[model samples]
Target: MRVRVATTILGITAALLAVPACSTDTAPPARTEKPAEAARQAAPLSSATLETRLLDESDLGEGYLRKPERPSQHNDVTVIGCPSLSELGGDAATGGTLSFPRNAKADFTYGGSSSEVSEELYSDNAAKLSHGIDRIFDATTSCPTYQVLAGGTPIDMASQELPAPRGLGDEQWSQLLTFSTGDRSTVVKQTAIRDGSLLLIVSGSPALVDRHLDKALAKATTTS
Candidate 1:
């Protein structure tokens, strides 16, 4: 049984977003290339371009069906327990100094059942993108357990760190989140991969995320 979150942030953040980079830097190469690579990465992508790169029903194959896009809108959510998450009260989907200039999103459900997978793309400068990813992961981890007030009703939420998938991106973060209302609880996994100026987040059923993460990254980076 799925415990759907009542709040916008919980719904979007849960179905919508997830985040880090480890400090295992190897020594820099003896030879360095021109700064062209830096400029290229800093370049922003347009929303249309982003949409083309997102996974479609075709890319996902046989039984997967794309879910309709949610309209562009925001209903603020209030966070009561975690100071780090307090910032989320204003805009949970996307906002603030490190704002992504362009974004594209797509959602899918597998086999006609409740199993789902969603992907989001954010484009900007590498530095800003990296910071944005960090912000999400940091806030979630700031409090292992927290409370949110949505629609005048208080909901209990929990965030637990999971080993992120490696060797797929420059840096990544993974977490298992639980949203509870009374005895019913909804569990979801979010894995975020940050490569250069692009940040890709794949979240939903744990199995679905793992099954298509590599595919999502490959398609997102390739030109149409």
Candidate 2:
């Protein structure tokens, strides 16, 4: 599975954590309850509103420092040797991650530690929000193990589906990704949860993501 396939576009920074996580073996289908999600839909919030809701240095408490937000940019990542993705066509870019018109994000570092965590919020119609995360999860199953070419550098990537944090939202998707190039390996955990028209994506070191997942979600769903 792609452990921290972090280039994930959600964070563009997911794979906009910006990130995506995975393992080596095939992953199961993402779990979603479409009918239930639609029934609970909340009015989609604007980007400005989501910005106010973004988790800040204080939200993460002590030891976690907010990193400067990077401007969103186009990613030219290409996936190689994934037959299913190839069959789907137009699915090549971003290794299956996506972007949205109304979104806000933040990145953070823990003390001086090199490890970081990220939060991304997306607001759109329910269908688009659901589809956005679904595409990334789809890649985990279709390209369990594949090669990613980032700036002409060959990166070996693998992904394994992780169980979503149960009952976090109307629907959820989770995975772990491992990115390797030579002796270096990075593991990232990505979990995307949606409530109404809002989608919250969190990615980074597995433990940190787990620690902050609930907090991030709570903030995103709170009514203004």
Q: Whose TM-score is greatest here?
A: 2
Compose the digit string of candidate 2's lDDT tens values, residues 1-224.
12223244522223322222332343454565556556665678889999998889889888988877666555565667766554544533354434677889887888655678888899988777887677757755556778777666777877777767777888888887777768766778778888889989888888888898999999888876
Query: Which ten residues in a row are the worst by lDDT in model 2?
Result: 10-19
Query: Residue 16 of model 2: what lDDT?
Result: 24
| Candidate 1 global TM-score | 0.77
For 66-168, candidate 1 gives per-residue lDDT tens digits of: 9887765544455666776655444432344334659898888787755778888988887677666667677776678887655555658777767767566
* Steric clash pairs (candidate 1): none
lDDT of 2 at 62: 88
lDDT of 1 at 198: 80
- Model 1, residue 117: C-alpha shift (Å): 1.2
